[model samples]
Target: MTPALLESFPPFNPEVRLQPPAIERWRRGTGTDVEFVHVLDSGRPGPTAMVVALTHGNELCGAIALDTLLRQDVKPLRGRLVLVFANVEAFGRFNAVEPFSSRCVDEDMNRVWDDAVLRGARHSAELRRARELAPFVDAADVLLDLHSMQEAGAPALTICGMTDKSVPLARALGQPETLLVDTGHAAGLRLIDRGGFADPGSDRQAVLVECGSHWEPASAEMALDVTLRFLRHLAMVDADWADAQLRVPAPERQRLVRVGEGVTAVTPEFRFLVPTHHLKVVPKAGTPLAEDGGRLWLTPHDECVLIMPSRRAGMAGQTMVRLGRYES
Candidate 1:
């Protein structure tokens, strides 16, 4: 399906960067060591925060932002700060010029969650690596898994679970396009959403930060700003950080929807409308939407976030569309 949707997914073949001195490479479920960034401040013990990027190799925006942050010489406040370069091998295969492939390698990294697979024989290396990052998520006050999504979309968006603790945090850290993707399915489980066996202790918070489409400058910049704002939101950094980037002013919390179980299939030759990442919505009578493919396919009837179809089209369900309203 994916192969037919777009021409082909591309991979970037850049030379790998050596590990930094402060960062450590540790082995977990994955036998080989992957680099993890851990900064501790026992001087004044406080809450711990873990920021992870590149769960999906193709989602490179977050990786750039985190790598940039790590390079910045900054001191931690009261609590400790940990940064992880979650998936390096998959990221290495990234090709900003192409789509689909950027998000993953052999299998989607985000969809590698399950008790059976976790307990499955030594399967794909990515599956093992995911288990390795579990401890980092468990030890934090907040977990921000940064990622760059497909489609030339709006401001930063978040994928959160159904919980008051999660809701308020998501709302508080609102991005202008505060799209509440119900994910009719839960986070991480969907090949698109990527579920994790992560823990949710009491009110611990986790967010899948979709920075922007791959390679776009705006996507990269937004990703960098949001990571810093997150530090302030968690008090990991101080006013200094906020004062630096206008601090993504209180975002206008917009429409929220459930990423329900509706399937949108596309033909092999489906191409995105160029110039802008715009996908036209074709709706049917007595039906919320319809497209001319013989008969209109029925859609979920409700105020839902249309997973905006990308002008850059792919196979069906490759992308979804939505018209978000201003949340007063």
Candidate 2:
């Protein structure tokens, strides 16, 4: 959808509970020789894993977690650990009064991941940053792209791209109570779905963690907890170090939700019949969920779970939400 279409929708006002951390000290990274990219190598043979933050400017939880990691001087024990602050230019423009307005400086960074878009002539603040970070992302064996939600009170979720490789990894991290397996966005391929990360046969894997609401302090804690667990899972960081850093206990169990279909807006007048949160379940089939134009959107099956229901103004072909079912 176009920026004009997004602008047409009324802005959502979420309560701000967490203050954005000052990231000026991390502008010059210690490793990789790239700005805002730090790489710590143990000089031993193991998988290289990368944890990324700030894919969207306003998602402060990931940034805060990464910043804390940097300050703590966390280092890898066997493999390489790469910490990246993506979309710094957009993040530089973040204003507490108008947080959502600074999500990107040009186009959405997450949407410009396809090879054609990166190699093509299109230029933007986000594209340039992604281009610089692509080599690092492409080289990693494991990746964790941290993000947060727009909807208030929505539970944390792990978006494990349409494959089972990342499912075990998500389950191992054990935070964010819900694991969603789905194809990447229709708008574009995300970093988690790029190259080997999306290839089922390949050993590479990536998971996008939507920690919680954007401005919540708990979201930042969740981000750090998950990141530490991820590093521990890869054997990049010592278990003792990870345990010391963890703020909350790992989840007792995780519910896996496999998305069956994405509900894209076919008409401009799309509206949900009920207020939905992430992972909200409808117990019966044919239940009215939304309306688009004169058409009523109904649940396709019993126990249909709603995933990431949109709060933004609906544009034609924009994903309003996704329908899924529990696997375990």
Candidate 3:
């Protein structure tokens, strides 16, 4: 009775440079309804800023970033700061030897944020947590969900859902040069897209930052950097302290890539034709990029950029890569 994730695929043993912090110390977080959730109120009127980590159990960088903040006793200067360690059930099972196996215990926690799924009769470890976490997420005026890529050496990026509001904020954060503007996933709605954050008229905004490779030491640093930038942008933390804590320089300019579509693996035999360590562009239309059980994925137009090409090859029904193009 082995978990599906533990099933063998291609061998990938990347160096685990960042260690998962001892989170048990933060278990009874501020007496929140859910464990590992802390709320820091500044006792002044302002927007509620939420920062979440461990959306996926295997992504250690976010956990590290949140842990660092907790240890430092970071407090919001203007309003409430809600810190969450999501998917702790799955995260509790993390093992560097078989890292990906703990991404979730039942299903992806992120994809369970849809209203139907959350209110539905369906049961899963992720959905249950999402239900417990929904209220805090709904209460936020802004949210930053930290994550990392599955592939090593992949460049850092921010996932600004097909929303006009988030892009401007991401541009302000500056680092993670690539900003991916995408439609909500076909699988399910993500936490960032949930509630009023997705409404055009709503002031609330959410951004998901893909820090870097999951186990890379640099990813943890980038995670913290983004968290600081997010707080600084919202004027949540002390200006002097946040500025001193910042490590990565803001990018000179950020590029926005609007995702056209995601290439889903229909079969377990899907394979990409090229190495996708970083973002790539197919120079011409109709060029074959991948094949899955005789079905070929061809570029729809020239200069099509491939985003976040996955390392998990044998997983069917998952998005292998996203097709997008740069603006201007």
Candidate 4:
């Protein structure tokens, strides 16, 4: 269904700075049944770590990082290192002029991970692709799904879903100054929140890294840095080599941001009080943050911090922005 809202209140057109990396070279399967999925088996027993990129086609930074890693022939030293280029059909449609339109072919791939959606009769370009990738995703011991924000100048952060297992892992990564602990979206379950990754009793772990703005050079750099750190953390790659590749210095300490609520757009007329609201904090409770048609959306608590405020057309049921607070 077409979204009820078809326009950004004040149209947002950010400059596209980074070129999408040429990924046609990695299309062929590398001894794996899945196309664009390469596995580096160390032949030694250890964890199966999977790193996925291009969850959103417009978010090219992760693809750049994965392409660079594949070009360098980085092999695992422990168990298997699974490198995935997801949503390639949508990625193939990426046009520099209209980048965001290609986020998915039919629907957002990130939201189709629920078991019923994966197993049911729902048909979409993303769902079919998700089904193909589900087996590998389920087998992973540690999963790192790379993504980027729509808004520029937003801080790099990690989405550690509502799991105790992931928060410590995100903290240990030591980059990306902020960490978000929240439940999976009401729209659908994200890949990180699927299967054993979200199970407290299971030892499996997953974290989604929002490197930075979609086309920024820094976002690509951050993606590669986090990729190296993730592999190093699992001992899948050499610590010294990974350290040498790291360009960004780790923050002295990371802040935990627990999301209290996600304001989902219910009407076509959803518009923020200001043009941009990423990381903006409302000092008082009940301050009007946005308006959805005739309904007003207010801050539920004092010092409500907005995270990843979307500039896209407010589709009904889409999360406009998440309200959160920083932990000391």
Q: Which number leads on TM-score?
A: 4
lDDT of 3 by residue, 76-136 (tens): 8998999999999999999988888999999999898979999999999998889899999
Rank list by lDDT: 4, 2, 3, 1
Q: How do all the candidates rank in terms of TM-score, highest first?
A: 4, 3, 2, 1
Error in Å for residue 270 of model 4: 1.4
lDDT of 1 by residue, 1-328 (tens): 3443232223323222222222222212122243555554536777777677777766666766766776674456768777777766676665534534645555556655554555578577677677776555556777777776555444566766533345556666656355444432222352222233133446566667677655566666677777777777767678676558643455544445445543344543433221122222224223333332333444444332345444433454443344322233
What stretches of model 2 exceed 4 Å from their correct place?
1-12
Better of 1 and 4 by TM-score: 4
Q: What RMSD, rounded to one decimal, does every model reach?
A: 6.7, 4.0, 4.3, 3.5
Q: CA lDDT of each candidate?
A: 0.53, 0.88, 0.87, 0.88
The numbered model that scores best in lDDT is 4
lDDT of 2 by residue, 1-328 (tens): 3443344344568887878888888888776678999888888988899999999989999999998988888878888888999989888888888889878999889988999999999898999999999999999999999999998776789999988889988988878788999966788889999999989889998999999999988889999999999988887788988898788766778989999889999888988876677788899999888878988888999999999989876888788999999996
lDDT of 4 at 74: 93
- Which of 2 and 4 is ahead in TM-score? 4
Collision count of model 3: 0
Q: Which stretches of model 4 miss by more than 4 angstroms? A: 1-11
